[model samples]
Target: MALLHRAELRPSKLELLVPWLPGRPWFAGEAGAEVTRVAAYRFDDPAGEVGVETLLVRAGDGPVLQVPLTYRGAPLAGADEHLVGVIEHSVLGRRWAYDACGDPVYPPLLAAAVLADAGQAEEYFEVDGKREMRPASMTLTGSRTGRPVPTGPVSAGPVDSGGTVVRVGEVELAVVRQPVPADVPPAGGLTGTWPGQDEPVLLAYAR
Candidate 1:
C-alpha cells in the first residue's frame, strides 16, 4: 500500500502542472486556464522510494490529460529536461519531480501492468496515531493481450518523455491523450473511467 500524508506540498502538484501543460507536445488545452484534478492512481515502486502516479486533469474546457509522474528524493541523473520541478514536501522534505517516461524506473513496471492484468496500488492514510485505508481518487485496471511477460528490464521508445506511441518490449503501448474516438480499436492495456465519462476508455494500450 502507498502511504498518504496529510502534510502539504509547497508548490502543489497542480501549481507545477498548470504552467507545464501548455508546453507539452501532447497537450492541446488552453494556456492560463484553471487546471482541475479529475482523478489519480499510483503504482508502487519496488524500491519503495520513488513515487509513481498517473494524474488525470482538465484545463479549461479541454479533454482529460494523462500525465505519468515520478517523485524522487534526489535528482534523476541525465534527466534534466524531463524534470518537472523541485518541491518541498512538508513530511518528506525536498523532492525532485520528473516525467515518468524518462525516469528509467517506470517502463518495466508499466509493461508488467500491461501484460500481467494488474491494478493500482492501495492507499493508506495515517491520522493521529492510527493508520487507515484511503479510497483511491479513481480506479484503474490492466488487461493483457496474449503476450509473454518480460523477465528482465524493458525499455520504451521516444523517451523524450510524453509520446503518442511508446514501444514497450514486444508490445507497443499507445497513449490516449484525449477522449477515445468512436472507432477506437478494442485492445488490452491499462483502462479506467472517471465521473461523467460514459464509457471506460483506454488510457494506454498495446497496439
Candidate 2:
C-alpha cells in the first residue's frame, strides 16, 4: 500500500516530461505537441523510501507514451546519468526524479509483476489526519503464462523507450512503452485499464 498527500508539485510531471520527451530516440509522439496526462499507476517500495510511478501521457492526438519514474529525497548514487529532473514537493520537500528503468528498485518489482503476479499498489489519501482509500487512476493486472517462478537478483538490460526488457533469474520481461493495437501481447506480463479505454491494454509481457 502507498500513502498519498494532497500537496502541490512544482514543475509538475508533465512540465518536466514535455521538455525531455523529444530527446528520447524512441519517442514517437508528434514534435512540439503539448503533453497531457492520461493515467498513472504506482508500485510500492517495500522499504517505503522511494516513490514508484508509471505515467501515461499523450502529445496532441498521438499515441500514448509511457514514462516510468522514481522519486527520492536524495540523489541516487551512480545514477546521475539517468536523472530525469528535480522537483519540489509541498510536503516531501525536494525530490529527485529518475528514469525508473535505471532505478535499482524498478527491475525486481517489474519482474515480480510479470512472474509473481504482483499487481499495482493500493493507494490511500492522507490529509487532516484522516485516511481514505483513493480510487486508482488506472488498474493493473499481472499475468504469468505458466512460466516457472522467478529466482535471484533482477537486472534490466539496455532500455528502449519503445519497449524495455528486463532479465530476471531465468525469464525475460518485456515492458511495453506504448500499447499499440497491432502488436500481440505475449503471455506473462502486465495489463492495465483506465478511463475512456474500452479494453485492458498490455503493459508488459514475459517470454
Candidate 3:
C-alpha cells in the first residue's frame, strides 16, 4: 500500500512543475500557464524505500501531461541530470524528487506492472498510528512481454509524440509524457484509464 501523509509541502509539487515543464521538450504549455492535477496513481516499492507516483495534470486547457516522479530520502547517485529539485515534507522531512525514468527503481517496477498486469497499489493514510485505506483514482494495465527484472541504468532519448524512449539495458520503454487521442493504435506497453474517460489512455509501451 502507498501511505500518504496529510502534511504540508514546501514549494508544492505543482509549484515545482511550473518552471520544470517549460524546460521539457515535450511540454506543450504556454509560458506562465496554470496547471491543475487531474488524477494520480502510485506504485509501491517492494523495499518501501522509494515513493513512486505519477501525476496527470492539465496545463491551461491543453492536453493532460504525465509526470512520473520518485521521492527518495537521499539523493540518487549519478542522477544529477534528472533531478526535479528538493522539497521539504512536513512529515517525511526533506526529499529529493527525480524524474522516474532516471531512477533505477522505477524501470523494474514499471516492467513488473506491465508484464504482470499489476494494478496500482492501494493507498492508505496513517492517523494516530492507524492506517486507513483510500481509493485509487486510476488503473494501470501492462503488456505481457515485460521482463521481470531491470538490468541496468536508464538512458532517455529525445521526446516525440508526447513521449520519450527510456532505455533500461536492452529494453526500450516508451514513456508517454502527454495524453493522446484514444484512436491512436496501442502498440502494447502500459495503458491507464480514469473516471469519465471514454477510452484507455496509453502511458507507455515496450519496444
The best candidate in terms of lDDT? 2
TM-score of 2: 0.90
**Residue pairs with clashing backbones, model 2:** none
RMSD of 2: 2.1
Cα-based TM-score, every candidate: 0.88, 0.90, 0.90
Q: Across residues 114-165, which tens digit of lDDT does each residue of candidate 1 receive?
A: 6676778888889998989987776666775666765454444552233455
Per-residue alpha-carbon lDDT of model 3 for 1-207, expressed as tens digits?
Answer: 899999899989988888788788888766568778888989999999999998999777778899989999999999998999898999999999998988887876776675566768899999999999988787777766544645677676666656767776666777788875443224346788888765788787766
lDDT score, residue 62, model 1?
86
Error of 3 at 140 (Å): 1.6
RMSD of each: 2.5, 2.1, 2.2
Error of 1 at 35 (Å): 1.2
The parts of candidate 3 lying over 4 Å away from their true place are 146-153, 182-187
Higher lDDT: candidate 1 or 2?
2
Q: lDDT for model 2, please.
A: 0.81
Off by over 4 Å in 2: 145-151, 181-187
| Total backbone collisions, model 3 | 2
